[model samples]
Target chain A: MHFVDRVRQRLDDAELQHNLKRTRGRNAASRAAAVAAFPDFDAVRARATEIRARVLRDLDLWLEAFEAKATESGATVLWARDGEHACELIIDIARRHGVRTVVKSKSMVSEEAGLNAALEAADIRPVETDLGEYILQINDNEPPSHIIMPVIHKSKEQVSALFARVHGTAPKTDIEALTHEARAVLRPQFLGADMGLSGGNFLIAETGSVAIVTNEGNGRLCTTLPRVHVALTGIEKVIPTLEDLSTLLRVLPRSATGQAITNYVSLLTGPRHAGDPDGPEHMYFVLVDGGRADLVGSDFEDMLRCIRCGACMNHCPVYQTIGGHAYGWVYPGPMGSVLTPLYQGLDKALDLPQAATLCNQCSVVCPVSIPLPELMRRLREKQMEQGLRPWRERLATRLWAWAAARPALYAWGARIAVRYLRWLADGRDRIQVMGLAPGWTAQRDFPAPAGATFRDLYARRRQGRA
Target chain B: MSTRDDILGRLRRQLGRTGSGLAEARRRIRDEIDTPRSGPRPSPGDDPERFIGRARAMLSTVDGCATMDEVPAKVAGWLRAQGLTTRLVIAPAFAGLDWSGAGCEVRAGAAGPHDAVGLTGCFRAIAETGTLMLRSGADMPPVNSLLPDTHIAVVPRTCIVPDMETAWTHARAEWRHWPRAVNLVSGPSRTADIEQTIVLGAHGPYRVHLIIVG
Candidate 1:
């Protein structure tokens, strides 16, 4: 099946209907709570934007400071220009350590680099310990559907079936019981894993530290319990100081899940200290550039300011319709729409930039005020300019744009199209299908024109008045 | 060139930086970080009682004592009231305290997997987000606060700060050599990942009880 058809089928699933309703309800509550929690919500968002802009403006200095400080604090820092380089560094670390099993908390960079596959290729087992990520991995290792809430697409009954199938356990109906089952299954993995890997939320330059904000506290477990701990993050995550981190933290949880603070925010500067009895022995920080540097001066430069809050997707109408999987990559939704095309190259993601309806909802709710719709439009223009669009779509757009340039020709063309459509309606008043645009007409009927076009109607009114 | 040099060079080229501009930016960032400016914070009222109230509002239970000696009894009383077991694992920092009189069996070390309750002392408590700041050290490891289902953190009244900014100020000055880990825990571990339904006790303490010693 084609990718678009598969997405439609998934969207039509009854289970997805239940899941999206739950997601919509939760997002509404979170948006309300976020607004209520921060009385100066706009001011906080503006401050966060300024801080991010400053960091991006002076990216080199902050990254250098972070690298220096982290190294000073006894961390081994590595750099990766692309995903393959990053995966190689991580796989090398695992191989050197003779790591049989590695546990990872949710790291989109790791997903972007396909770290699990690389590790598996080298005879290493990569285990996902986060409950949502664990669920995704156990079910054929599908990429996370949502950035923040990975399993928001799965219903309780589906999860029950998966657990019963995977663990040979009794089906669980209670959410708490289901959670307990996951914890029971994952605790051993956490204890037995040779190394732990995680993604850094904010890389603090001043203290040479990296912060991971999580509600489950698995971030701590992953970074602490294992012998070797590694954090894979993009270079854009670097901020100047802890003070700046506090500013971002104030808005991050509030904007993301409508919480005053997440349950745990861990700041790890290095591996275990000299006298420390428990924690990781060696810490590694792999800074991945991964095509973000290419966007440093582009029109879509603001895309780098994203903090991965999933707010844009939560607020986007198109994303709400098609869901994250349809976006076809590690990142999804409005931010993903711009990012996937840029990171993976435009040729590989022709349909993603066009997934939007030019709705300003994503940008309005964006914490950093990233002009997501504007970026998507720019990508669409780029795609058109480069002839990346499908032949039919390109021809149709060219024909419309050509006709639109001349007012008289556009009017005549519209009048003729209306007459033809009306005739095709056969007194039914609505067209159920069209040969030219069957996909558009498949879901909903198109209204047939009753008589003359708007221009013609206006001309008649003017003549009657005279 | 090495990958590091290539990445840095690419970033510099993208930013349109010349030779001297990089050094100037580095110097400016150094100055910026050295003189840390406090960010905007919520007005949770300027009182210790307000801190306690806010902490409680985050679903963390709080109790206060007139002195450090009274902390054990309060801990024992809370455990009894909640109908929980009296077995507890206290951090070594609180080892000298007499917990035997409180009708509870307590030990001082890291929390094991089977341990239901663990106690540790917080470096500071921020009233802004109702957060407890725990720095990892020999006296109190991270597992004490993390592994147990119920974590009882003892926060001295002097350590309660108005916001996160002030708390960081104190942390930077006090710990010249920063610890390996600094955990800012707001409440018990919770996740909304399951169909966006909030569930507590997701791999961290299900309950966090704060004892404020004056």
Candidate 2:
């Protein structure tokens, strides 16, 4: 489907629009608060970027060292080349552990690898314990629409309806009521589950520790309650030391939700200590490459610098307008647009690269300064080189490119196009056309090209000076 | 591909010739290290009060919360007003408190899922970041703080620090003797998934009442 059409569909969903509006307002307020709180927010962002860059540059050395240290601490480390490999590794662990029920906190890596479906196919139940995730899971729908808020697409009323259907009881419209219901259901699963799965926001190479951040206590319960704890994370999550982690911790939550820090930041070094009263006995860390290693040396290496703060998405006009589902991936918004193409292949995600308006707001707001817009442009260039562009678009761009190279020809062409557009617009100064450009004007008016070309205006001004 | 096959394949591809041997050697090394180290260690070189100040600053920046002497009454009133009163699991730190006067039933120890409220005392409060750290143990079972409809934490004013670094140092020193899960809570649970709507109490406690006992 066309990008505009998909966005329109998401916008048409009243619940999504309502939620987006509220989240946008809250994020704005929180971000302002965070900025006010951290006068060194920019410095923290820069430091985080530098640390991440250093880690990515020496990824192999760090990975080997981290593996050695983690294994020494009595934790098993597994490497997966891609999502398929990651899923296989998890499934194997589940099979060996005889995992009948799995309780999960919010792990973006699991979502990316489609771990839930893979486990269920093997007859293992995967339960999402995060309140938002639980609501989405009960609905039995697609992956989360937002990175932090998985069910951002569902309104409280919609959630209430879904809960009522799943539990065979009328759900309350109140937020507390909804949360209480989810907690009631998930608490038992946390105790009964054979394995607990989570995603690490940052992995400390020096300490062999995985840092999991969450607001609700699910992340902690998921790691400590179960006999087996599995952490899935991209290789880019690694940092050199706890000091580096501290720098990131200072910035990530502030950038993400405008909090000084999340409520729960659990750093697990290894399995339960010998004398420790609680915590998992078997701890596994799955480091998935998933096309990230290739990005290490490429221009897109900066993408790895991301801490998944979701600030870019939060500030993105397109994201705020259409929401995440329109991107059609686990990682949505600008980061997703850049990553989906890289991981899923540009051909599979042809429309995603074009999802943005090249506004550059995403890059400006990005904590890590990934140059998202430039990377997106490069993806578009690659798509064009691959001849993936539609026939009509290719012809239009080709014609424009030809004219653009020669200013004299471009001026003449522009003059003719402007006259033609004026005629088409008649006296109204607006024209509704179908085909490729209709999406641009579907809900908003497209101003007719200015009556006078830039060359014409410039020449008239010069003449007036004469 | 099977999980074993996948893991084996990864091991072979990444580690080459030393993969199997290294795996075995690593396992042996872990088994060999049985006793905890008790050697004299260098000081961390950071000041406790400075870290506490930082914690306080962080909490203030993040809109940290604190309760006062009137907190018990406020909490009791809030819970009662919310029409929720079944059973409360109180932390050992809260043992000396007079709950009978507040007209609330309080049980000591971990709370079951059916329990209406879990009441505990925060070990440390970071004022800079506005966070409360709760360590799991006999008195503060992790479940007592989690797995309840409402979580009421009684944070002493004295334990409040300024930043996480101070909290970390204090926790690390405490864990050297007895290690357990340390939970740092900043605010009530929240989510913004539905069109980015910020909704509190997604999957955990919908109501978090801090009874700050000065």
Real contacts recovered, all predictions: 0.75, 0.32
TM-score of 2: 0.79
Give the TM-score of chain A in candidate 2.
Answer: 0.92
CA lDDT scores, all candidates in order: 0.87, 0.73
TM-score of chain B of 2: 0.64
The 10 consecutive residues of candidate 1 chain A with the worst lDDT sum are: A20-29
lDDT per residue as tens, model 1, B108-188: 888888898999999989987789999999898899998888999999989989888888899888987899999999888
Give the CA lDDT, 0 to 100, for residue B136 in model 1: 94
- iRMSD per prediction, in order: 1.1, 7.5
DockQ of every model listed? Answer: 0.77, 0.21
lDDT of 2 by residue, A1-466 (tens): 7666888798888877877776665675677688786677777777767777766655655666677768877899988877878889999998898889999998888888998999888899999988878777777746787788677656778878888889987868877667767777777889899999999988866557788899777898899889999999998787766556667777788878887778677777778766454678899999888877667767677888888888778778888888888987788899999999899888888988888888887787677778998999999999998999999889989988988999999998889878877776777867776233687677677567766998999999999999
Task: Provide the lowest-lDDT 10-residue window in model 1 chain B.
Answer: B38-47
Summarize candidate 1's per-residue lDDT along A265-299 as a digit string, tens digits: 99998989877868999899999999988888778
Look at candidate 1 and tell me the lDDT of residue A41.
Answer: 78
